[model samples]
Structure formats: structure tokens, C-alpha cells
Target: MTLGFVMLVHTAFDRAEQVARHWAAAGCPVVIHVDGKVTRKVFRGFRDRFAGDPLIRFSRRVRVEWGTWSLVAATQVATERLLQTFPDVRHVYLASGSCMPLRPIPELCAYLDANPDTDFIESVTTDEATWTIDGLEAERFTLRFPFSWRKRRKLFDRYTEVQRKLGVRRKIPEAVRPHLGSQWWCLTRTTLQAILTAPDRAEIDAYFSKVWIPDESYFQSLVRNHARRIESRSLTLSKFDVQGKPHIFYDDHLQLLERSDCFVARKIWPQANGLYDTFLAADRPSRRVAEPNPGKIDRVFSRANGRRAVGRPGLYNQGRFPRQGFENGITAARYNVFCGFDDLFDGFGAWLARRIGGRVHGRLFHPDGARFAGAERVFNGCLSDNPTLRDYRPEQFLTNLLWSTRSERQTFQYHPGDTPEVVDFIARDPNATICVITGAWAVPLHLSDLSFADMRAEAARLQRADAAMTATLQSAGTAARLHHWTLADFVAQPRDRMRGIMHEITGPGPRRVTDLPPMRDLTGFPAFLEQLRNDGMKPVVMGDFTATPGGRNGR
Candidate 1:
């Protein structure tokens, strides 16, 4: 009724020897399988190191390539050797060189003795298996994977595509309903022997040899036919990341592993001296009563997987530069984009800063330089107001600004006359709050002392820019909160519009805006628009305005 181990050793020979000797000392027989790819000199040295132990034996080497039949071949040879060489072993525990025993050997032996007939292996139907990676679920069983996924990835992908296009699926044997799980398992000798000596073993092996990553499915699938009672879970704890790569446990994961209560854990870092020293110690405590529950530490791995996959929102790094429209968020926090507001109202940035209680910057995309709130050359995160740097990657500059000042609401003026490079980005960003007073750029042109000809040409250019910006804001795909007001429409009820804008920025509050910012004189604003129209440069975004009889548009 004693336990036996079959270790699949490919790397970390020194650590493998240490673990093998430890198991031998605890009276459990072990069969070692060194990968054929290992150099003869290294294999001979590794074999010699374990020669003194009678409980240890080496199986025939197999050249193992990941996601190919070689891995299954290696495991088959090692597992068959273990069953034959150690007849007294009732349950054969399959492990890897990097796997370390988390619990004392006596406790694991006793636990297996309690469930002597129960085979502990994770065998679930493909539909039930959530752990499969790379979009290959049942396809791994049906499709042929001749190319090495690790070495010849392009060939593997192309071959898989060709198979799919040609509808070339391998016929799975009628007895074998494909089941996938962790490659590691612990099975009773009866079940293991039945599988190795099944009447149709040759046919099953031939079919699976062409299956993708057969090591995970071969024993996992056959156990159904031979096993008396299946627990449908592995005693060995192994975790894979979002990319289907094993999570390597380092020294820091010592406590994390202990919490799992699993008998063995694999993919340990060779440099994890703390784990080896503590777990392999002679006096390691035995927890016979506790059930193996890797779920205790699942949250930690789940969070790690999430961070690696989705990453933090609005934070771009070399590893996770998300594709467009796939970013968690385009900007870090909510910010304001005031288009044409500055021209319509005097000292708008300062006024908005008082109303919203946040930093208010003026013309951040201005061609001259960023007109920061205090006219400072340098801002948060040492961001320069230089037009060249800002224009080089305007979206990045805006994102950096929001990321740096995430603690406060950011309000910045953006006119069509300024750089319109970041306009589309802001429109797509859900964090942006855009308040536009369309055609307010005309107010600034009306105040300028430029010649009529100069004014007309500049007006046309600004109008074109404004039209583009408005189209983006009004588009069906825009995510930004838009508050668009025509120049004439806004001037009619400036106070009401300002209050609404302030409320949206600051959310609902008791403190009302007692007074509105003073509006610039529009005495000849209508004449200015009429003059532009007469000169054949239409200012249509301004909305129709009627001249006041008092010689000025009333404040």
C-alpha cells in the first residue's frame, strides 16, 4: 500500500536529486525520467548522483518537445517503469523535477491510503474545462499538432489554419471522449496498469500521438474507463497564467503554497532556497486531517492573472499597450475640455477654477505654448509648455496631464484655432467633459485689429477646424459628455448655460453660482459676421443673430 513517484525531470538536476533522495529517505520508491534532449554528460552526471539509492530508477529517455507527442511519450515511459519496477506501490503519483512536497511524506501516504481506490486527477470534458489557453479547447483533441508550438510557432499556426480550412480533423476513438486537465495526477496501480495494458492501447496511443499536447489528455481521458472512483481533481497543485504558462513559485510563495494544503506543487524556481530548506526539512509538520484545497490561494493567482492580462486602467507600459478601443480607460480621471468658452467669457479659466475648485488651464494645445493656469513654463510631472513637445504626441500630453493631476478635476480650454490633434482622442475618452460654445472663435476674430481680408481668411480656416471638432463630438461613437451651445444661443441665456456646465462639472451641490463671468462686448459682433458672409466666408456655426437697437448686444 506504499506510495510511488514518477518524476518527469528535464531541468534543475540538482534540485531533482535533492527531492528524489528526500522521497527515498521517506521509504517511497521513485522512477526518474531524464529528458533525452539533455546532453549525455549532464544525464550521466545526474544519474550517478542518484545511483546509491535503491528506491530510485531511471526510465528510458524521450526527446520532449512542448505541445507534441514527445511529452506524452516521456510520461508514458516513466509511468510504465514506475508501475513495473515498484509492484508494492498502490498509488503512483506523477510529478515534475521542480515539484516540491508541501506536506510531510507520511501525511500524504496516509491520505492516499484512506482513498486507496479513489483516483485523484483533474479530468473534465472540454466544455467544462476553463483552463485551456490560446483558443484551443476541444480543438486540441480533434486537430493534429505536428509542429512544435514552442519552437515552430509560425508553422504550428499555419498548419492549424490549413487543417481548419481543409476541415482535416483527426477521428477520436469511440472509447475516448477527450478530457483535459493538469498533466500531473495521482492514480491507483489498478487503474494505471489497466491503461498501460488495455487491449486497444496501440490504437489509443496512435490516435493521441497526433493530438495536441496529448500529455494533458491521454491519462486524463483513459482514467474514466479504468478508474473505479474518480475525484476529478489533482492532488498536485499547479497553476497556469493567462497565456497557459505555468506560474513559477519563488521564495516569496512559500507561505502561499503552504496555505493551499496541496501535497505537492510544481514549477518551483530553482533559486527558491527558502522553499527547499523549509519544506524538505526533516521535521516538516504533517497535516493529515486537512483536505487538499488549492482554492485557498486561488484568489491570489486570480488577481495576478487579471493584472497580467487586463493591466491597470489608463496606464500604458511596454508590456501592455492595449489596442485602440480595448483600453480599460483612455484617460486616468475626469477632465474638462472647454472649446470656445474662453473667447465668449473673460478670464474663463480662472472663473471655472473658482466654480469647480480645480486647476484650470488655458489653451493647452495653443501653437505658441501651453498657456498653463499660472502661465508657468513647467507643470506637474515636469511637463513643458513647449509647443513642439506637446504637438509631437498631443494625446500623450493630455493623458499625462490627467494622470498627474488625478486627485483634482482638470479644466482646460481648447479652441479650434489651437492644435486640434487631441480632439478625436478627447471625444473617444469617456472621462472627458466637453463644453463647446460653437463659433465663439469668431468673437476673438471680431476683437482683433487685423485687416478685413486677413480676418476673412482666418475666419474660414477656424470655421473649418470648428466644424471638424463639432462633427467628432456629435458623432454616434463619441463617449465624452458634450454640452454644445451656438454662440448666439448661448449669449441669449449665458447665466443658465454657465450654471448647467458648472453643475455637470462639480456634480450636484448647494452652493449656486451667484454671478456669471462678464461677457465681452458684442456691439458689432453681428456686423462682423455679416461682413464675413459678404466677403463670401460664411460663419454658419454662429447661428442667426439680430442686431440690437441700443448699438450693442446687451450684457
Candidate 2:
């Protein structure tokens, strides 16, 4: 996912720097479009903050507005310039001064790489534009404005009355109905270019001319109008709290933020120096590099310094399992292990929520049984805004085999429906890994034989389980070497040692799978490693099986 970030900076210099520092660390090409109305002193000060890094782009200052079309104009123009200036860039994201990078840029980029042709512009159902939400609808009047905004100021209220009577419907074409939503997005290079060079540029431009707060709806509406396939959500993951901030990124919101798994978060306060520091501190353990701005497309393992990467690649069978769909083929070049579990433990589901709420090197998934996606469950601790309890289920035997890390960095996907895409993702990428069988169920795989009598039957089962998932990746042009392994064979082996053994059995293939890691290994990770290595049957340990994150979705 060769992504270039564009941040709309207004007055918050410190917040801009804070976000910049965080972004710079992720190794993405960053472009800052400061409000042109600001003084040179302001721009220069921000410039000095990133003096040496060449990847950081600074656009000619342009005045932006809160509810005006200027915001959209500013972002679109900046994005255009970036595309022209950096033709090689693959993805362009429109962000705000308050946004912060949630995942490492490389993982995010690799994800985008798997879905090349798709445009991630803001999109909603066609009727959403004229639809009502939270007791308000944009299309209710010939013109629509956020209800909160109307309530905030008397002047705006009067403006709404006048606008309503005037019926200023901005001459929307017969086919085009604008969806009023967040403008922030991560668009592919082609879409950004097409948007910039839209043939119906005049028509599109005219549509937003009279829309109140066109900035919020302009890009969102235009992209949908031109899109073949659109993701109807902003890439930035935010908490929807009663406080009604445009975004939810308070330091206190960390647990849910990590759980949500959206790559970037926005609208942070500049004065929260301690907050930024705390973020850096909390994320310190996951840091892939020691320096601030590393190179773009950071292959953490491939890096000369051999930095331990943080985010997990969602690859399995050479296919990747993102939130919406499955992608296959050598997803991430780096080594990554994603884990999952069976919902067997008492508090295991809740315990697992923490991991999904945090981060993962790959994906965080759970199983109803043989099915991959089923129900999801979060820890009871998380119910109170912030998750409290940790050491749940207290499986001494399990803990003894693993040392608890700072927090769970995982995501959960319940597989009641068939999604064979998981297998393809794991098989396509040789280095990518996944976990299965949570709680006590995953432990038996280590101790018993997991081979099946009827090979064709097993294949038939998997094929039927997720025909669409299987078809999607296979259609994408990648074949997988599918096989069955007995847990009895893999039991009592170090995970790394297990991989070597698997390599021998599977041969030098682009994609393959061996077995799931025992996440409930409370014994201690070192001990678990030692056990898995003892038999040379050990494969890569994706994660200890237990309740990780969002386990509550099991319903």
C-alpha cells in the first residue's frame, strides 16, 4: 500500500507536529497542507520540526474552512498536487491536523496493495444523501445541514431557515445525489487522478457550489458518483461518544481505538503534550525502528537493522482477510503470524478482546467450530469504557508456557458463514501465518494427531464452507497447495522449529499452512517455544489461543 498522507493543518502547530512525528515514524510519504491564512512564522516553525526529511511534503498554504467548501477544495487541490509531484505514490489519504497514525505505514500499504483497483473514497448507499440519520436527514430540505450545527449557533439557525425557504438544492443532476459525510479518506492513485481529471468536472463542481458545508459532502459525493466499487466508510476509525466531537481520539479512548483497527485517528488536541508522549510510550513496545521517520515500504524484518515490526499482516494461504473482504497472493513480504481461538474459556473471550482492541502482526480471528468467522466477544472489563481485568481464566498451565505481553494486539472475525478466503490468504503468502482453535481446544492440536482419513472429504468441506471466499482469491490469480496436518504430529514442538519442519513437508511453495499456536499457553512463551521446538514439529506460533478482542460479536 504505497500511501501518501495529506494533513490539513490550520492553527494547531504543536498538534500538527505531534501527528507528524507519529506519521513520520510509520514511514509513509506525508504532505502537509497548512491553511494559507497562517503566517510564515507558523509554517516555518512547523517546517523546522521536519527540516531534514525529504518524504514530508509541504503544499503552498491555502485557506481552509470548518463548514465551507474551502476544506474540500483545499484537500482535493493538495491531493492533486501530490499525485502530479509523486506519480509513483499508490494511495492518497486526506487527513486533518488532529489525526494520528494508528498502524505502521508498511502494513497499511501492503493491505492497500492487495486491493489495487478499489477506491476507498467516502461512500454511502444512494439513498443515504437524502436519508435521515440520528433523527436528522440531509435531504429533508432542498438543503441539509448537520442538526448539531444548527443547534450550536443562532446565526446558523437563521441561515438554515433562509436556505430552507430558498430551496437551494444546488442543481443536483438527475443521477447524482450527494451524501453528506466526513471528507477524510484513503483513495488510490487512479481514483485520485480520475477525480482530479473528471470529464464531468463542471457538473460535479457545480453540485457542491450551493450545498451547505460542501467540504463534508463534495469529495464524498463526487467519488461515489464516479466510483465502480466504493467503501462506504471513512478509513479513519473514531469513537462515537456523546461528547459529539467530530472524532473520538482522547488518550482515554485508546482501548477502543486499537480495537477498531482503523489505520489512522484524527482531531487530537495540540496542547495534550502528555497525551502524545503517552501514546509514544504505550506504543514503544511495538516500535519497529528506533528513529522517527524510517523509509517508506518498511520491511521490518528485511530492514538492515532487523527491527521487530509491530502490526500483523492479515495474510493466510497467500490471501489477506481484511475487515470487508479477502485478498490473496504474497500479501506481505515480511514474516507475520495472526492467531485465533475457539470460544471455550470462561473469561477467555473477554481476555481476547484486549488483543483485538490493541494491535496484531497479522489478523485476530475466532472460530465457532470448523468455521472461521462466527460470533465475536469482548472482555467484560472493556464494558466500562476502558477494559479493566486482564489475567482472566487464570490458566496456570497455559500462562506458564507464555509470558503475558503488555496488552493484546489482535482483531476478531467470527466465521459461522463460509469464508475460504482465509485459507487462500494463508496459502498465497509463504511468510504470513494464522492461528486457530482458541482456549483449551487449541491445546489438543499440539498433543494429538490432526490428520483426516478422507483428503477429498476435507477439501470438500473447506470448499463448501467458504465457496465465495475460495472463488474470490482463486479468481484473483493464485493457486494454493492445500493439505491436512494432524495436531498429534505437531504437538509438543517449538513454533519456529515447527516452521522448518513444515517447510520440508510443504516444500518450497509460495503459500502453505501447518498448525495453530497455543495462545492460552499461560506457562510462558519461552517454555511454549521450547516445547514446540522439542519435537521439531513446531510451526510458527501465530499467537496464544484465548479470548482476544471483540469476542462479543459471537452473536
Top lDDT model: 1
Misplaced by over 4 Å in model 2 are 126-136, 139-141, 144-156, 166-170, 241-244, 271-275, 278-555
Q: Per-residue lDDT for 1-555 in model 1, tens only?
A: 489999999999899988999999999999999999999999999998876788999999999888788888888898899888888999999999999999999999999888989999989898765767755878888888877877998999999999999998788898798899889899999999999999999999999988888888999999999899999899989998988888999999988998999999988999999999999999877745799999999999999999888776677757878888888788889989888878977877777787777888988999999988888999987899999999998888888888888998888899898888788899998899999999999987899999999999998999899899899889988999999988888887777787898898877889876686677778778888888888788789988787332133244
Q: How many backbone clashes does candidate 2 have?
A: 96
Model 1 whole-model lDDT (C-alpha atoms): 0.87
For each candidate, what is the lDDT? 0.87, 0.49
Which ten contiguous residues of candidate 2 have the minimum total lDDT?
Answer: 393-402
Task: Write down the TM-score for model 1.
Answer: 0.88
Candidate 2 positional error at 248, Å: 4.4
Measured with C-alpha atoms, the lDDT of residue 109 in candidate 1 is: 92
